[model samples]
Each structure stands twice: as C-alpha cells, then as structure tokens.
Target chain A: MSETLTIFTYDWVPKGPRGFVRDLRLRWAAEEAGLAYEIGAVPFEDRQPSHFAHQPFGQVPFLTEGDISIFESGACLLHLAKKSEILMPRTPRGEAETTEWVIAALNSIEMVSVPWWFLGLSGDHENGLSGWLDSRLAHVETVLGGREWLVEGRFTVADLLMADVLRIPQVRARGDRPASEAYIRRALARPAFEKARADQMAHFAAADAKRGEG
Target chain B: MSETLTIFTYDWVPKGPRGFVRDLRLRWAAEEAGLAYEIGAVPFEDRQPSHFAHQPFGQVPFLTEGDISIFESGACLLHLAKKSEILMPRTPRGEAETTEWVIAALNSIEMVSVPWWFLGLSGDHENGLSGWLDSRLAHVETVLGGREWLVEGRFTVADLLMADVLRIPQVRARGDRPASEAYIRRALARPAFEKARADQMAHFAAADAKRGEG
Candidate 1:
C-alpha cells in the first residue's frame, strides 16, 4: 500500500483487468487497501506474450508490485485480500468462507459456464453444452435467486468475479429475464459498480477514437 | 479425528474423481491427517436429481463431515486440512502459496485441458480450445519441468490438487518425455494415491463383472 503500483492491462478499452469488473475488483481492493496505483494498458494481441509470460494462461489483469507478479484473477484478488483487510475479513472463518466462494466461482460456476459460453460466442456451440448451460443457469439462479450476492453482508471479490463471468453475452442469453439476468443488472447498478463501468467505458472510447483516426 | 466419517463417492476409480483425482485428494489428506473414513460409491447415472440434490452440479465426490456437507474438491481437501497439520502447512504464507497452485491447477492447467481431453475421449473437438490447451501445457511443462512436487519440501494439498488435475491424459500427454511421465509416476506412487486408484478400479471392475455375470 505504500508503493506506486503498476496494473498492466489491455490497450484501447478494458480487456481483463482494465474492464470495470476486473478493474473494479482490483480498484475496490486497492481503494479498500488504500493503495494508489497507475494503469498501464497492453495491446490485445500483445497480451499473450506480454501478459502470458507473467500469466501461465494468455489472459489480462496481471499485476506487478515491484518484482512480485501475480495472475489468476482469484489469486490476484486474494493477494489484495492478504495485503488489505477490507476485501477479505480479518477472521479465520471469514477468510475461509471467502475462499470457499472464490473457488466456487472458478471451479463450480464460471469454469464450466465460461467454456460453454465462450464456445458459443466463438460460434461453435456444442449440443451437450447447450443443455448443460441451461442446467447451469438454473442452478445459478436457484443459488443466487434470493441472495443479493454470492455471500452475505457486503460485495466481496466473489461478486466481482461472478458478475463479470455472468455478464458475457453468452451467459446472459441463458436466463432470458430470469433471475441471473436480473442479478447482473442489479449488481451493475451499484455506485462502485457504476464507477467501474464508466471507467471501462472511458477506456473503450479512447481506444475507439485512436483506431478511428488511424 | 474422533468420529467416524463418511465420504460420498462413486466406486473408486481414478478417472473423474471416483477413482482418479478428487477421491485421491481427500484420502491423501485423510492419510496425512490420520483420520479413518468409509467410502460410498453412487452410480453415475444416479448422479442426477437423486445424488445431485446432494451436489447441485450432478458431480460426484461430496463429503459429509458430521452435519456439514462440503462439495468441490479443493474445498473438501482444504476442509480436511483443518483437522491436522500434514496436507496443509501451518503458516498463512504456506497456505497462501498452496492456495495459488491449488487454484492454478483448476483455472490454468486443468481448466482447458480437461475439456480438450474429454473431447478426445468423447469424440467431439472444436472451438480452438485444443490450441489453447497446447499452449498451456507448454507453460506447465516449464513450471514443472525440474520439480518433483509443487511447493516447499514434502508434498502438500497443492500437490494433491495439482496432481489430480495434471493426471488427465491430455495434460500428461503434454510431457512426452521420460522426465514428465516420471514426475507423474512419483506423484502416483504415494500409498494413499495407490489406494485411491485401486478403489476406483474396483468400482469399475465391479460394474464390469456384474455386466459379464448378468
């Protein structure tokens, strides 16, 4: 929290860490940690060699604090938690519960849903996966239907990771105004959420304007 | 440690957790923790509304620790670590380091590889995922090239979870060399792992034997 941090993100608008959901995750964690940081955006194509060198997978939202580099949205987010007290609660039970949800987001929900959704987005929808997505959406709605978020009391990184994964158009297409879609809208409406969204929008506008002139 | 524990799983097989990874993870942790337990294998087709009611995702290998029902392999393994000192280390930093690999196993290496391997087995490959898997395997090979285990000194739950994820043929296939295969062999040679594999084999054998006799 004492040093000036660099968040290596995507060029143009938000790619991974640059987007509201990804940025907000880091930003909220940073704000909560009281860490002032700068954003350094990397081009989309360059993300593989540039970002993947740091990240085992070719994805965005990698973080560098001095010599330490971390990837995996969950790991980086939890890095914030370990460094900061606000994102993750101080108690053992709280940390354990927070980890439970984090793993759930990656392993249980997002892991399966993201692949299926991405496949569809890429225009190669699987026959079994379509049914699987339907089943997955129903289960998500059932679990998250009544709750305001994945966990209690406040918005944790669980919400941040979950919201972004759910926001993808492929995932959104599953609900058709059911509980999942409603949840995304409600989550996006929060003040922090709005700031995150606007921040991401500004990134895209800058990128688009640059591309247009070129 | 004091009470009899029951683990809900399929007749132990090494593939898909009945015999393969998740069960190995728990039993390994149990061995490390010095706890005695019973295993109950449920049929795969039965994993639907009947068993999935116990676990929403229609997945196998959930745990009933007295009254607390736990799902997800990492959480289950991590939960078991709470009772003792072997599978999980004692310090926060140790746990954090373990948590990163445990997560990386799922999100990075196993995430795409599992699907690609499954497609290879199930006979439907598409969506440019295999290329991504290839790239990811190279990263895994580099990270794991020289190491026998994942973290400091002796084996930890991170290794168990990672071992489980990497045991997939597609992943193991990434390492065509003697060293990589030996790395996997060393991981499998653990007595706890052997027991888990045998259990899964028996489960499959029982099914086959029943069919043959019928």
Candidate 2:
C-alpha cells in the first residue's frame, strides 16, 4: 500500500486561530480527493529547528508524502490537486485556469487581506491597507458575480483556496459582497470542508484536554 | 509553426516603476526557457474591460499561448517552467521543491515585503509591518545562507521569483543580509534577467517616444 500522506501543523494554537489554521487547507484538499492522510504536530509555543527545516518561516501545514516534503499551503494544495482529477481537472486548460486562480488567491487577495487583517489586530480596524483590500475584494466580487466556479465550471483546488481566503472573518465582515459571500457559502457547504474544520477543531481540543490532564 | 506566446502589459508606466513591472518576470522566465514570445500592450492611462477579463485585478503580465490564457506572474512562471528543463527539472522531487519555493517566494516573502513597501510609500519609512517583514527576511537569509539555489542546488523558476521579490529596492534596503544579497546578485547576473529587463525598458521607452510624437 502507498504510504499515507502526513500533514504537519502546530500541536496547539490559541483559541483565536483554531479553526483557521492552514493545515485545514491540506486536510480539506485530501478529503475532497478522498485521500487518506495523517496529521503530525510540532510545538506551537516552542518551535524546534526541525520545524524550521520543514517550513522556513516556521509556519505550519507542510505535507510529507513518501520521500518528498512540501511547504507552503498553496504548494501543498497544488501537489494534492495533481493526485486527483476531482481536485483539479486533467486537461491543460482546466489545470491552467486552476493554477491561475490559485495563485490569484495567494498573491492578489491574501497579499492585501492578511496584512490588512494583521494591522487591524492592534485595534486599528481601518488600517493603511483598507482601501487596497477593499479594491481587491471588489475585483474578486466582480469575478465571482460572473461565474459559479473559478475554473472549468466545477469545484477545483482554485475554488478551495479562493474560498478559504474569502472566509477569513475580518475579510468577510469588511463589506457586503453578495457574490463573493455566495461563493464562500457554496464552498463551505461542501462535506470536505466540513470534515476538515471539524477534524482541526477536534485536534486542538484534544491538545487542550491533554494539557488539563497533565 | 506554433504561435509564439504573448505577454500582456501596460503600454507605458511612470519612470519610478519602469523596471519593476511584473511582466519582467514572465519575460525573464521565457528568456530562460528559450521560448519565443511577443509583448502586447494595453493602455496604461485607461484600463479596458477586456484587460480586467484577462486579469481580474487588471494587473499586467498575463500570458497567452495558443488558446490558453494564464494570468498572475507566479502562474505564468509555472506555465513557462513546464516547457523547459532549463527552468525546472522534470523529476517529481525537483519539481516539488521548485513549486514549493516558487509559492514561498510569492505567498510567503512577497506577501510580507510588498505590503511593507506599499505602507512605506507615503514616507512612513517603518510602518506596522516592519517587524514582520524583518523577521520574514531574516528567515529567508537563514535559508539562503545554507544554499546556493532554492531547489536541487540549481537555478530554477523558484530562484527567479525569489530573486525578483528580493530585488525590490525597499525590501533590499531593509537590512544587511549578506546571503540574500549574494543570492540576488547571482540571480541578476543571469543573461536572461538582463535581456528581460532591457526589453521591458525599451518597450516602455518606445511608448514614451510615441506619446511625444503624438
């Protein structure tokens, strides 16, 4: 039998980031493709050198399959997408569209929203990136309004990632973008996303329970 | 004969952003892959609906090859990388490493640095993202210090994207990271990068002359 894919994430995170942790992205992709995977954990409070070796930024959600280990949730999603036509279509155009939207979510939208959200964390709700973030979101809204899926008129890793970026609470609450909202809603309604979120929540909850027991 | 790949960019840009436009990334990649390509232009002063259709963010550097249209410089690089082993190795492990680092350069490093640079544009030399940017850069420095190339100890599209992100003046000036400095220097020394930058500069300079004539 082929070795099960292993996803690495923090053993525990503060309540604020429990469900939103990026390991859920890898897990969601795996579930969508019906691929079995196991979760591995590194310490959240004290990152080891080994963790940095796996993820240079010491971030989580790196994946290991057989001898190959990959970092960056976006990259991991692409790797998983390659394994199943269910995650990404096999055709050249379909793959190209999926890849483009995946990069768009990472480089275009999250590039603005993540920093904007970070600035807002210090209680400055409308920070320097507000206008830029709003403009990006508006563009995404325009695109979403015109299409049901980001690629090939079906659910793919592109939708998986774009939806994840849109689902960030701070980003979602920023404005009323009905099409983007509907897109996110439709993506989250998938059983794979549901399983991924629940599994991630339970993993962290178990860690909390273990701490209490000790 | 196959149609040459076409890259789309703005007809003209201000002097400040002349060399830094992202079409350079696609140009550099094509040059490295030894692929024949042509440059096309959209009006810089007035972005048309068609431009937005090709690039949802209305940004430039989308590529068209035959019937396939791909946007996002990162995605374009990947698309081009597939064409030549000179840009990316065909082996699964090499490709995985290259893809991860490519996404890392885009989603990880640029995600922090670009916003940090943008926030600094209004003369706030050190903005809210300064510490985050520094920490991220320091991590990159550590990675670069130990390796000559981002993947497989050879120059790949990962190095191309990472070097491009690091070359931004604001990000480059942030600190004295010798390893990263050397990496950037090494990458810029490539003839492909030189040709891409020169071609891009001349493309815009011609536009300047045209406007003067009109």
Candidate 3:
C-alpha cells in the first residue's frame, strides 16, 4: 500500500466510447475504496512496445503499483479489492462469493454481451448472438430480482463490475428486464460511479483540446 | 486445507460436451496440486433449485469445500490456486502474473472464442466473429511464441485455462497459430490433464449406463 497506484489508459478515444472506457472500472474501484491514484497515458494511435510490456493485448486500463503491474480490468479490480475490505469482505466465504460473482460479470455476462454488441455493429439487430445474449440477461435479471447487490447484502467490487457490464447502452436496450434495469440505475447513481465517469469524459476532452479536435 | 474438497458437475451431459465440461478445470487443478477430492453431481436433465442456489446461472462446475461453495470455472480455479503454490506461485509478482493471465484466458480469449464457436454451430464457417477471433488467436500466438508458460516462465493454472480455451477443436482449426497449438499440445500432454479428462469422460459414461443410454 506504500507504493502509488497508477491506472494507465489511452491518451485519446472517439466520442462513441468516451465515458465507457475500461479504465473507468479501475477509477470507479479506486473511488469506492477511497484509494488515492494517478493516471498514466499511452498512445491510442500507436501502441508502443512499452505498452505491450505491461499489457500484452495492447488494451488499456492496466494498473501499476510500485513494481507490480497487472493488466485486465478484472484483475486490476481484484488487486485493488484485496487492499481494502470496503471493496471486498475479508471473510473466506464472503471473499469467495465476491470473486465468483466478479468472474461471472466478466466471463459469463460480458462474454456474451460484448460479442453481441460487436456483432450488432454490422447493422443487424437480430444477429446470431441475440438470443444467447437475451438468455444471459434474463438469467441476470432473475438474480438481481432477489438481491440489492451482487455479492454481500452491501456494495462490493462484484456489484461495481456487474453494474458496469450491464449498463452498456446496447445491452441495456436489448431486453425488458425491469429488475436488472433497476439494479443498473441503483449502481450508477452512486457518487463513486458518477465521479469516475465524469473524470473519464474530462480526460478525453482535455486530449481533444490538445489535438485541436475539441 | 483441512476441509474436504468437492468438485460439482452435472451427472450427465450430451456427447458433444461430455469431455469439455468445465468441471475438468477444477479436477485438473486438484490433480496438479495432488489434493484429495470428491466429485459431486447435480441432475443434468432437471436443474434443481439446489443447483441454482450454488450456481445462479444453473451451470455445472460449481465447487464446494466444507461449507463454502463457489461457481464459475475461473473462480474455482482461483480458489484452488490460493491453496497450493504448485498451482500459483506465492510471490507477489508471480501471483499477480498468474492471476492476470488466468483472467486473460477467461475474459480476453474465451470471452470471444466461446461465442465464436457458438455462432459457428449454425453451419456458418465465416461468421461475423471470424475476424475478431483470428485477431485474438494471433495475439495469443505472439505471446506463446516467446514463453514456455503463461506466467513466471513455468506451468500455472493460467496455462491450464488458456490451453483449455485454445484446444477447442473449432477454435484450433479456425486459424494457424503454431505457437498456440504447440502450447496446447504441451499443456494437454501433462499427466494431470490426461487424468482429469479421462475421469470426467468416465463420470459421464457411468451416468449414461445408469440411464441405459450408453
């Protein structure tokens, strides 16, 4: 905890993904945990060897604290979760449930929603993955119907990650899941999420002004 | 470590997914760690409320050790990884690398590969996910070309999961990633992996005999 936490993200991105970048996950987690952090930037137009050295996939939202660098937003969030009980309960069962739901958000839910969103870019409303995505969302709706948060009865990193994945505009609009929608609204209304999102938008806007594209 | 470990999976699955069922991930990790464990089965034909209680998605491969139960193959592997250094190094950096790569396999690689394979099931060889899947495979090929294992230059659960994701017949045949293919071959050649696969297949076969469907 002595080392400074740095979250790295692209220097700039288009408006379409301005507020939805994965780095926002790390930002949101830090905000929720009250962890002080700094931001680092990598070129969006030209991914460098240095970037790949930290994140092999050349994706952003890698975290470096002292000498430890971790990539993948989920991994980064888990790393942060370990540093604070506010993000995750310290009990074995509580930690296990939080971790299970975190992986579910990434592997089970986003696994379908992201691809379905990608395929939808082809202007096909009813793509091959549409039904699968709907089924997954329905399953999520069922779970959300019974709980206020994903892991414990209170907010945890699991809820943060799941709400992030579920709040994507395309995924939200795809189905009629009232419980899931309410869950998203509740999660997004958090001050931490609002600050994280606003900060991300402002970060990109500053870059846009520098490039004379603002 | 004193609690008895049990890996839960469906009592039966169709021939198509008999070998590939995710319980193999936990079984393989247990074998690698030389952990004594038992297999628990849920009804595959009729997923009970009990199954949903353990795995909200009603998916197989949930795990129980004593009083704690966790779902998601990635989460189960992680829970096991925490107990044995053989599955994951104890050093901070090593553990971080192992975890980052494990999530990469689950979130980065399998995130796309599973859906791509699912889409390919409709007799469409050139599905919309073809290009995206190829790009992901190529990135993995590049990483594998330079390393013997996914983390710490040695075998870890990360390699176990990544190799499982890549070895899917449809995904492997889709592109020529020599390094990834070699990585899969080396991983699958391990004694633990072989035993895990054979045991899972036999478990399903025993169930088939009970139903007179063998």
Candidate 4:
C-alpha cells in the first residue's frame, strides 16, 4: 500500500489539448476510487528513451506502480479498476459487463472518433469517416438513452472512460443526441472529474508560466 | 466449472468475411487455452431484437457463459484470459504487459488499419488517414523488429490479437515490414489459430449449403 501510483504524461502541452490529455483518465479514476497517486512528467518537446521504454508509441498517460508498468489509457483504467471496488464491481457478471463497455469506449467509439477528428483537421469536415462515425454515435446514443450508468446500475470506470471519449468537443458537436448530451453533462459534473480537470489545467498553466519566465 | 462458454457469431456470411469474423478471436483463444466451448449462431441477415440485446451494435461474436454475457471481441478475449493463464500471464507485471499490448492491438493498430481499409474500399487507396496509418504501422514495425513477442518472451493473447490485426492481407501488402511479416506468420502457424480459422470457414460453408437448400 505504500507504493506510489504514478500517472505519466507530458510535462507541458499547448492550449488545444490542455484538459483532454489522457492522464486525466487516470487522475479521474484515482479520484473516484480515492487512490493516492502522483503525476509524473516526460518532456513534451523532447520525448526521452525512458518515455518510449514505458509507452512504445510515444503516447502520453502511461502508468507505473510498484513493479508494474502499463500504457494505453484503456489498459491503465482497467489496471486501476482492479485496485478498487469503487471503480468496478467485484462480481464476475458485473466485471464482465464493465470490461465490455470499457473496450466499447476505447475500441468502438474512440477508434472512429479520433481518426475522424484527425481527418477533419485537413479542413474537410465531411471526410471519409463521417458516415461511420455517425453510425457509431447513434448506437451509443441509444444505449445511453436507457441507462443511467453503464454497469451494475452505478457509476463505474466504464462510464468514466465512455464519458471522456464522448465529450471531445468536435465529437459532441457532430450530432445532437439528447441522451448522450445529458450523460456527458452528468459525468463531467462529478466532483472527481472536476478535480481531475482542474488539476490538469493547473499543471499546464504552471508549465506555461515557467516557459514565459525562461 | 460446469458453465458452458458459448461464442455467439452470425450463422452465415458472404465469402468476403468468411475467415475474418471477430468470433475467430474467441475461438482462437479457446483453442489456445484448450477450453471446452461451443459456437452459437444468430441469423446473419435478419438480426433480431435478441441479437441487439446481446450486442447493442448488432455485431457478431458476443459471448455467454452461465449467467454472464459479454460482447466486444477484445472483451471476450479478456474474459477468456481470466479463465486460463495460457491466454495471459498470471504474474502482475506479466499480466499488465499483456493487457497493454492487447489494448494496443485493438485501440492502436486495428483502429487505424480497419478505418483505412474501409476508406480504401471506395477506391481512394490513398485517403486522408493514409499518413496517420503509415505512421502507426511504422512505429509497430520498429517495435516488432526488436522483439519476437510482444510480452513475456512468449506467445500470449496479445500476440494472438496483434498478429490477427496485422495479418489482414491488405495491411500486410500495404507495407514492407519483414519483422511484422515474420511475426504474423509465426502466430498463424500455431495449430490453435489454424483450427479456429478452419472451423470458422466450415461454419459459414455449412450455412451456405443450407441457404442453397432453402
């Protein structure tokens, strides 16, 4: 229990990705579970070999605790979910349902939305992935319409991850699903999410100030 | 222990997707783990309310075991992993590493390869996602060049899924990564993968005969 849980992310990033850095996923999970943790930083401008040693893709938000190291936000979230029942239910059926939704958010939703967002960056809003992304969003909207929480009828890491994936500004603006909109509002309104978002913003703001002073 | 693990897939499919359906993932895992399981099928053409009840998206390859029902191939793989160490490592560090690579395959590699392939189907072989997909594949190629296996110096479910994702003919033909090619060949060389693929093909072929009879 004395071992520290460290969420690793870039030391600083620009304005665009401030609150949305994936480390927020880890921070939010920790906050929800009341797990003591700290933020560790890798240089945003110059990723070190040690950084890639942790995350093969040079992506942010890898995690290390004790002797265990893990990357991929979805994987890291599952790792944290193992530590606390607050993040996941202990029953086999509950765990299975939770895991399915977690993967659905990562493999199903983010898989399309992230690339679609990237293609749209070229100023072509209705790119090749537009129709596919809409279909995925519609499916999720229907699911969210009927469920207050993703699994076990309560807040779990699945909801945390799903809400994060759906809340991306571009993705949120792409369609008007009242249920999904209300779901995002409900999830973001959580005290744990608020604290995680504030902490991430402050972390970046501090980096900005240091760069200015330099 | 008496619970039967059933992998639910579409009863039939066109030749185009015969060997590539995601249910092969579960079948392959079951074969690898030597777990006793059965295949259950839903009508491919007339997806019923029951099918959607299991898979909100009406996708094939949902799984049910006793009282637990789970969907998402990645989720089913993890569920199977929990039932047998042969599918995953038992140690904490080893398990963490395996899980990270599993998510990497699903969220990182397939996420790009699948959408890229979808867009390419439109005849625009070089689409907006081309550069990004290339960047991802190149990074993976570099990683594969340095290691024979993704985790624990042995074939784990991570390798099974990664190899499955990489072995798509289009993805393999898209680039010249000798290491990735070797890795894919090595994984598919396993009897478990071979049997799973053959069984999937046979299942669809029987469905074809029944359709002809009707």
Candidate 5:
C-alpha cells in the first residue's frame, strides 16, 4: 500500500466546467488534511475503457490508493476523512453527524440543485424544480443561520462538501440566503479550497496548451 | 449506548406512498440483518421541531441506535452496515466497494430519477430530465447485465438502496431494460424486503384507521 494517493479527472474540459469540476473536492480534502497526492487524467474527448472501469459512469474524481480505487466524490471524501481527523472527527457521535450532513449535501441538496441547474440550462430558470430547490435551500439556510459549521460546532468535510454544492454560481444567485451565502464564502475562503481551485485551473490550462501542441 | 435500535417515519402518509416510504429502506435493512428494532412515528400533517431536529429536510427514515441519531437513509444504511457484516462486508476493500455503489445509488441514479418522477407528476413524463435519466439507467442496465449484484458478487446494502431507488414505478416503466428489471425483481423478492414493505403498509394503514375513527 505504498502507492501515492491519486485523484483522477478529465484531461481537459470546456471553460464552462473548468472551475466547477468535482476533482477539486478531492484536491481540497487532501490539501486540508495536508496529505500528499497526485493528479491523474483520462481523455475528456474520448473516455477509455480503463476510465469506465474505474468510474462506471465515466465521470471524474475517482481516487486510487494502492490497491483500492473508489469512485463518487462523496465516498472518496469519506475515505479521506477516515484518514484525518481534520476532515472528520473520530468520535462516533461526531462521525455520524458529519456523515449525515455529507449525505444531505449530496442526496438532499445536490439532487435538487443539479437538476434545477440542468433544466435551467434550456433558459428556463423558473422550471419544474425551482420550488423544490428553494425549499431545500431554505432548509439549509435555516440550519446555517444557527451554526457556523454543519458538525460538532467546527469546520469539517461536511462543510467542505456542502459549501461546494452550494457555491454553484447559478444556485448562488437564485435567492438571497445570507447565511448560506456566508457559509459558502467562509468555506471557499479557506486556503485549502483556494489552492485546490487554483491548481485545478492550472491543470486544465496546461491540458489546453498540450492539446494546442498536438 | 444500551438503547434499542429505532427507525423514524411519518405516522401516516397517503396510500400513494405507503409501501414506498423511505423508512422501508431502514426496515428492509434491519430485516435483512435480522436485527431487533422498533418503529417510531412523527405526525405527517404536523411535523414538529423534534422531527426537523432529527431530519433537517423534514424527511422520513432517520434512525436512532442507542445514543446515536442519524438521518438520510444512505447514511443510516452505512451506519447499520457497520453493525452487521450482513449489510456490508467487513473487509476494507469489500466495504469500500459497497460504499461507493451506495453513494452512486443516492447521488447518481436517484438524483436523476426522483426529479424526473417529480416533474412527470405534472403530466410531463418527457421533461428535461428524461434523457439524463435514460442515460443513467442505461449505465445501470449495462452494469446489471454483466453482474447479478452490485458489489462483490453478494447481496449488500448497495443493492438494497439501488433496488429501492430503481423500484419507483414510473422510473421502472420508462424503458425496456430487462437486466435492470430483473435485478430489481430479484432484490424485491427477498423475504426481508417483502416483510419490510408489509410492515410499513400496516403501519400507515393503522394510522388511516385511527384517523377514520377520530
């Protein structure tokens, strides 16, 4: 189990998705935990069989550590959380609280927001999912209004993932949720998130240069 | 830490959601693991702050085990899995495989299917999410065609969650995916699922009878 931690993503994506790619979630977690990791890439234009083997949906941000390769950014984040108390507290109560919030960020929030955003892509921002998204976001705003972080009264990977899910520009602009807005601002302001975003931007930029040369 | 295991759900939901209520997921898991548990109810028409405290989105299917209270069926399943190797494998690799697929069920498949189903409730089955749902289901069809179970050649919590997600009538009827259909059929055929479904139906039916009497 001596292999370096590797996070996989597309070699290049269009400008629209550059900053929002989920690979940043893994990189941000690794940085927050001060863990050394490397980035691996698969062709974005033509996904290979190996990529599909690693990520069944042919999506990005699958992680490999020695013999174990795990997909789903949420699962990968939890895997990393197990390695560092910085990402998640070790106690049973703390861990359960964090795990529930992480799943909430994925199943409850993203499930609504991503589809709402997708439907809005057809220029119907007031689409079928608008009310559902607003309800979910309003619940989150209520939760955030009362707490600085999602778990244990402190920052955890739950905050990292929830903030990432909420920070999508379209979703951010959908309403005036000052608490959620402040939560996202606080999360993105972390040095780890900043470095992760910058590094991801640079990775895609280098891929663009390589594509030009080819 | 000496308390009994308990699952929480609405005391009554309309007949439309009786067997399909998410507490069925927890009930199914407990039945599968042969664990002793009790059912707890919250008022469906009048959700209390206590209910919201347990489930932020005011959703059903949160679980309490002794001192720990966990929400999100996905999180609760994972938590229950930790208690029994019957729900999830004990080995690290086996557990990780089960976990990733569980998250995939929640984040990947249900994320699309649920919203699609919700939009279709307005009589627009061919809404914006149709193609996306088809694509995701097609991937699952491919995977299920190649393997009977979702993880490690055995029944796990991943299959339980996935089967529940895919068992939505509208989503199931969308396309002629024989493999996925067979997979769901096989999962639902389990005695545990049958018992869980019957118990949930009885619970809600009893509530309906009580309402009628009042």
Candidate 6:
C-alpha cells in the first residue's frame, strides 16, 4: 500500500477534450474511494504506442499501481472500488450490481450516447444511435424511469460512470426528454460527483493556465 | 446455492464466433471451478430484450448466478474467474495483474478487433483492417513481444479472454503474417482454447446448414 496508484490520463474537465467521458468516472472513483493517486496527462498523439504498451487498446485512463497495470475504464474503476471504500457499496451482490450499471453505462448507454455527444460536438450525429443505440437510450431513460440513482438505492461507481457517460453534450442536449434530463440531474446532484467534476475542471484549468504562462 | 444458475447464452462453441467464444470462456471457468450450470440460447435478434433485462446493454453471454446477473464479456469472465478457482489468481496483486490483462483484451484488443469482425459480418468491413488494422496487428504482435501469454506465468482468464479477442476473424485473417500467425498458434495450443475453437466451428457449421435448408 506504500506505492501510490498512478493513473495515466489527459485532463478531462474545466474545458479540455479527453478520452471517453468515462475517464472522469475513474477520477470520481478515485475521489469517492478516497485513495490518493497521480494522473499522467498523455497527449493525443502519445495515446497510442508508448501509451499503448500500458493499454493495448490505446484508450486512456490506464492504471499503474506498483507493477500492476490495468486498462479499460470499467476494469480500473471496479478495481479501485474493491481495493478502496468510497465508490462501491458493501456487499458482494451490491458490487456486482454496481458492475451491471457500469456495463450498462459503457456498453449500452455510453457506447451510443457518447457517440451522440461526439456527433453533436463534431456535428456528425446524423448517423444517430441505431443498431442498438436508440433502444439502449430508451431503456436507459426507462431504467432511470423513476429512480435518482442506478442501483441498490444509493450512489455507487455505476452512477459515477453513468453520469459521466450521460454528460456527453449530445446526450445532455436531449434536454426535456424526461428520462435523459432526470438521469443527468440525478448524477450531477451527488456531492461526490460534484466534487469529482470540480476536481477535473480545476486540473484542466491549472494545466491551461500553465500552458498560457508557457 | 439451491437455485439454478442460468447462463443466458447461445448454444455456443468456443472457436466459432466471438459471442460463443466468450460463452465458452465462462463455461471453462465454471468447469474449472466445478459449478453446475444450464445454458439458454436467446435468438440473435432477441438478445436485446432477454439480454437487456439481464445485461441492460443488450449484448449476449451474460451470467445469472442465483440472483446475481453479470454482463460485459470481460466482467462476466472476471466475475466467474473471481467466484471460482484457477482461472483468476487469488493473491491481491496477482488478481489485479490478471484483471489488467482482461482489461487489455476488452478495452484494447476487443474494442477494435471485435468491431473489425463486426464490420466483416455486418458487411461493413470493406474498409479492411489494412492501414489501421495492419498497424494494430503489428503492435499487438510486438507487445505480445517475447511473452507467450498476456499475463501471469501461466494461463488465466486473461489468457482466455485475450485469446478470444485475438482470435477475431480480422486478427485471424492476419494469422498468415509471421507475427500474427505465431500468436494464433500459441493461442490454439491451449487445450481449453482447442475445445473452444472446435465448439465455435460446429456452431458455424450448424448455422450454415440451417441457412442452406432455408
């Protein structure tokens, strides 16, 4: 436990583009878990090789703890949940349920919704969420149907990841779509999430100010 | 423990397709852990509803163990590996290391490779993994670098999932290339993988036969 967990990432908030929004999930998980960690900002070009060795997929948010390295934001978040206390609940099934929401956030909601955001951000959403995106979002809206959080009745890693995923510009742009709106608000309401988002924002702002000074 | 463990999956084989390959990984984990399980094949199209209820993401090969439902091929494989023996190493760092490989398989390899195969199956891969595909193949080939398996000193769930991800048709087609060819051979050498591949082939044959009959 002496070795600090070093997280490889690019600043994701306060206004910089980064890997999938799930990167913020890792940030939130770290904050929620109360485990102090280091973040390494890898430039877009470096996300591939030098970085790819740590992550074969060339995605961001790879975790390096001691000699143990992990990729996949889902994998990293859950690992931190098991090792730490904040983002996860206290039961086997509870953790498993958290994972379910994580998968839903990533594979279902994040996959399509994130793209929708990217499309809107890049003005390329014409090829909307189909082949699984449409129904997935509808299901997401329904799942949040009446709930404020994702599972077992409290905020957990699932909500962190889901909230981050839903925060995508396009997904949020769906404002007043009932489920979508409620889902986003539910996520943003959590104090832990708010802190995490704020932390991400500050990190980017500091980096930007540094760049400006440079 | 009295309740039946229902595995929502296609009557799948290991080597045939990606979905089935993943199912076989779960089965192998179950077998290694000495768990009794039943299988259900949700028609391909209906994977959405049946799987959505269980998966939320509406993808296939999820596990319903007693009341715990798990999805995300990597997560499902990891959960079974965790709940069982041998498949996942028990030591904290060991488990974390193995999990990293699982993450790599899903986030890195599975992300692109699986999609590459989908493009082929969906008939959208006319894009051919030529420039990008060739580059990634070479990269995987290299990181695979002199290492035989993805993680740990021996085979684990990481290997199982990585094997499946690496075995994607897109990657398989590249098997003729010196490095990729070598990688596939190393992967196929495992008895479990051999079982998995044969299973996949039979499933493919049956599907082709059914298609011909129609």
Candidate with the greatest lDDT versus the true structure: 5
Work out the TM-score per prediction: 0.79, 0.98, 0.98, 0.97, 0.98, 0.80
Task: State the lDDT of candidate 3 residue by residue for B1-214, as single tens digits.
Answer: 5478989999899999977999999999999999999999999889999999999888979989877999999999999999999999998888888889999999989999999888889888688888888888888898999999988889999999999999899998976788988899999999999999999999999998999998
Q: Is candidate 3 or candidate 5 better by lDDT?
A: 5
* lDDT per residue (tens digit) for residues A87-199 in model 3: 99999999999999999999989999999989989788698888888888888999999999987799999999999999999889986899999999999999999999999
Model 6: residues with Cα > 4 Å off, grouped in runs: A11-23, A40-53, A56-59, A111-122, A128-131, A174-177, B1-4, B11-21, B31-35, B43-52, B119-138, B174-177, B196-214
**Deviation from native of the Cα of residue B205 in model 1, angstroms:** 6.3
Report per-candidate DockQ: 0.38, 0.90, 0.82, 0.83, 0.85, 0.35
Off by over 4 Å in 5: none
Q: Write the per-residue lDDT of candidate 6 for residues B153-189, one digit (tens) a residue.
A: 6767877777666666556776445655666677667
Flag clash pairs in model 5.
Answer: none
lDDT of 1 at B191: 85
For each candidate in turn, give its C-alpha RMSD to the true structure in angstroms: 4.3, 1.6, 1.5, 1.7, 1.4, 4.3
Model 6 accuracy (lDDT, Cα): 0.65
lDDT for A88 (candidate 6): 77
How many backbone clashes does every candidate have? 9, 0, 0, 0, 0, 9
TM-score (second chain) of model 3: 0.98
TM-score (chain A only) of candidate 4: 0.97
Q: Show the lowest summed lDDT stretch of 10 residues, model 2 chain B.
A: B205-214
Q: Over all chains combined, what TM-score does candidate 2 have?
A: 0.98
**Between the candidate structures 1 and 6, which one is better when assessed by DockQ?**
1
Runs in model 1 deviating more than 4 A are: A1-6, A11-24, A28-53, A64-68, A82-97, A126-128, A175-177, A201-214, B1-6, B11-18, B33-54, B81-85, B88-93, B124-127, B174-179, B200-214
lDDT of 4 by residue, B54-140 (tens): 999889899999899999999999999998999898999888998899999999898898989989998876888788788888989
Give per-residue lDDT, candidate 1, residue A118: 54
Worst 10 residues of 4 chain B by lDDT: B205-214
Pairs of colliding residues, candidate 3: none
Model 1 interface RMSD, one decimal: 2.8
Better of 4 and 5 by lDDT: 5
